[model samples]
Target: MQQTYQTLNALTNFYGAMTAAESARRGYIFLGSSQDLQRYYNAKADMRSQLQILQKQIHPDESQEKRLVSLNLLVNQRLSLLEQSIELYQKDKTALLIQNNITVSSVQIREKILKVIADIKAEEQTYLQDSLEQSKQSIYFRVFIEIFTTFLILIIILGLCMILENQWIKRERIRDLESSLAQEKKIGDLKIQLFSMISHEFRTPLSIILLSAQLLKESLENLVDRQQLKNIFRIQSSAKIMNHILTDILILTRAEAGQLDFKLQVINLENFCLNLVEDLQLFATTANMLRFQKIGSIFKANIDERLLYSILSNLLLNAIKYSNNETEIYLILKSEADMITFQVIDQGIGIPLAEQHKIYEPFYRCQNVENIAGTGLGLAVVKKCIELHQGEIIVESKVGTGTTFTIMIPQENT
Candidate 1:
């Protein structure tokens, strides 16, 4: 029994030490602070000491000891990569960080270490369970032999044993739930990291494409030919679309990871809505016009400007994309005493009645709109932003006529 507890304690401590080392390494890489580096070194030493204790505790189980050895090897490999990452960052070689294998290998090694640790813990749990069963059987058999005649006492002891068994089962269920939650958290972190890496990789090329397209547009302004200008515009538009998709994915991942933040401030909603419409009008055509309307005299409200911008901009852009160029779009801002409402009305190819509920799901597009070029992320992003603001949106639409989106958010965030 003592051995089982010692092994379980060692496994828990080893995992904690591994987490500390990882946190410290990433912290040092991000901040380049001496204190962070010192923490990493301290964690590294503690990890080694913990491993020694873990090896000693699990020595009776060959399988667990072997798992520990494998874990140690992976930890060492990750530690080396972590050190290399710090060295490269300090030398102004961050550009090489993505091209090299260090980042990928480090993540793989860490995951492998975690797997080994989980396996060891599982084995330890089994050992403890087996020990408990043996102890239970021995005590029960002896007690029953001594009190075989005392039927009431036997019945009472049996009831107590059943209660203890149920409690143990409940404890095991809780532990399993905790383990599942931990796995989910790990998956969420990986998603954020993977999306972040993808965004970083695409951002530079997209920026260059936009810049080049802009330069070409400017340099060809005097040319008689409109074909080259159109091509340049196409390039710019495509790059912008790609950038928006990347941004949406990053936002969704952050929101899923519970990292999205809301910052509320007092602002004039009327002015904000007007400015947003004006900015969006730059993308409008002579055939398409944007009209803005404001209701209520006092327009000041507390809200997160960025989240509101995302929600409104996404709706407006979606309106523009799905509508005829000659159609008019209306953006209405209605500020009340305790609530503010935004209505974006567009004469566009409206959403299907059957699939309207799925529009807010990530990567879900209406079957009718498959011909249209979209990643199907805009509405999802808008929905996420609205949810962050603790608001609600109503969509009123017809298949071929038009769509109206109304969003209402409380003036004071609760």
Candidate 2:
């Protein structure tokens, strides 16, 4: 009973020390900013006036912050030292109680006190990490505000310049200014829409992957069955989907900004398409949904192998995703006079007439098919990739009929 009482007292002291340390650290952080320091002093004086009332519930020990002000140790060491001091104080208090015949000596009390100190350090480390994360969030918020403010300022300057020019010049300038502003607004809206779509689409699937992996890791004993392997395959499929979305965003941004770099080489188009089809077959829900409609003859193309692969892969993946569960997705390659045309035809819910024009706009989902899953940037990336290769994409679709995307690229130079 005596030993238990000592342990309780030690725990109480430890908590009190931690609370005091936290209060002091907050006080110091407050001092770092003039506005916060002013508030702190006002609050401190009010507390000082109510000390008698506060003392009823608070400890009489001096604040840990004040005691460690002169120490030169790192933050972790300071916290550990404070905990050690509290442990010593608890031991002395316990010893005094024993001397007065109020309690008895406890075995291994020192070891227990040290263990408590270690636990306190662990908790403090956790607190420190949380604080760092909060600081980072604050910094990011400030940067976003600053960037938006700069954009507004530029828009205002452009408006003023348009108002002050000569009559004829003013008309032309205003037209250009309005056009630029409209373009900027479109870009901003698309970015916001894209970010929102990405956040929602990626979070659920990524979380599933993580949760499934964690479960398998924790209990492999009874989970070594066909079901477990199927679960693992599910995670792999989700990861591939995420990778495709990320690749689309990257290639789209690079192409839009005219920064896309390519290494041209001769690649066997037939073998390339075959390999791609094989790799993507695993991602298909059924074998029939994914197929390669072979070209009339083996054809070769001189192009960036990586870019071409990404373009075809993105197109094929989207066909599989947007098509009906059992519908066929065809990958047809045909060589004409001086170009090769690749067609991805899907017999799924067709694009609406109203949204057909906006299909290639970044993050612009068709109104009729918003229920389907997509980042809405897939087709935009496909268009950019085709344009970069001096190619063109033609879309033919009818509502409730189906859609076919035809991409034509110039044949490789001999």
Candidate 3:
């Protein structure tokens, strides 16, 4: 009974702390007082304390333990959202804007938290009711029931034997399934490890080959034969394409393992876009086929250049690959106070409207692209990179017309 009381108290205290933190956050945002900031910090501490207490109190209840995992996540998200609101307000005096944006999210998270708490309380109450009812039963009544149950059990022995035999067969099948699943997991792990190793092994040589091809092409600058020069350039282009493939493979493997590395660097947006376009255009072996443009005031940004490069390069290469040699592909860049947007537009073989959803899937090609030479990993790689940036991608396309990919990623003002 005392433990039950403690568990309920902890649950209520956790809720109270969250509410206090939210109130303090709003108070600080509106009033900008140090006292409110201090209150917020205190409330944060109390919430953690309550969470720990609840963890201990409900440790024995398996169902409650699972509920606690979700509860923990909700509380963390709420706290982070509240804390971020305060931080953003401090940085930009964005009280009204931030509050308005988070109002719906805040309400939804709180409602979910309340629902989970009520469920936990209901479970505990039912359990307590059952305990109380059992306590009220007389000992003689229980003995009578037990003796009656034993007689019934004797009469149902043959039925029990049959049920046990069926249960044994089910257990055997379950064991086989478990074994098969274990084997599959082992094979999958090996495949990932082997792929990582092979990508690393081949990427190094492919990079060296590209470098050598570049150097060889330069060294043979004095050669008058156009055919040799063209062959050398082909070697360089093929090596570049191969290097890009291995890179995508490595990235996909790392992303699957949840270890994609992200590091931000200051980059000139205009120069980056221009350089990327120029490089990919050379690889496309086309004359002035790609167009680049920029919008908005900001030109410099702190961003993960590697991931950004992957996202843009894949989209650009795909644009070049899918579009006709005579058609123009556009790379549009826009920067704002709070976010950056990229638009990759291609006026070539457009994706079928019905097949757009499957494009982001790795190695998935459109039915119309059957005659095209591609591994279909480009858009999938782009999708992974966009996710790592915590961004969103939208696609608009029509069969036999064209396609446009718009990506928006959030970042603070430079």
Candidate topping lDDT: 3
Please give, for residues 159-239, the per-residue lDDT of candidate 1 as tens digits: 865775576556556667777677667767867776787678667657766654554454355443775567666666667
Residues 53-161 of candidate 2 have per-residue lDDT tens digits of: 2233322234422322211123234344433433443456343333322111111332443454444333433443444444545544553454355446546744754
Runs in model 2 lying further than 4 Å from the true structure: 1-228
Model 3 accuracy (lDDT, Cα): 0.78
Cα lDDT tens digits, model 3, 263-340, are 888787887998899889776747688899999978768788989999999998888888877788999999887888
Flag clash pairs in model 2.
none
| Model 1: lDDT to the true structure | 0.76
Off by over 4 Å in 3: 1-192, 225-228
Arranged by TM-score, best first: 1, 3, 2
Q: List the candidates ranked by lDDT, beginning with the highest.
A: 3, 1, 2
Better of 1 and 2 by lDDT: 1
- Number of the candidate with higher TM-score, 1 or 2: 1
Each prediction's TM-score against the native? 0.54, 0.48, 0.54
lDDT agreement with native, every candidate: 0.76, 0.59, 0.78
User: What TM-score does structure 1 among the candidates reach?
Assistant: 0.54
TM-score of 2: 0.48
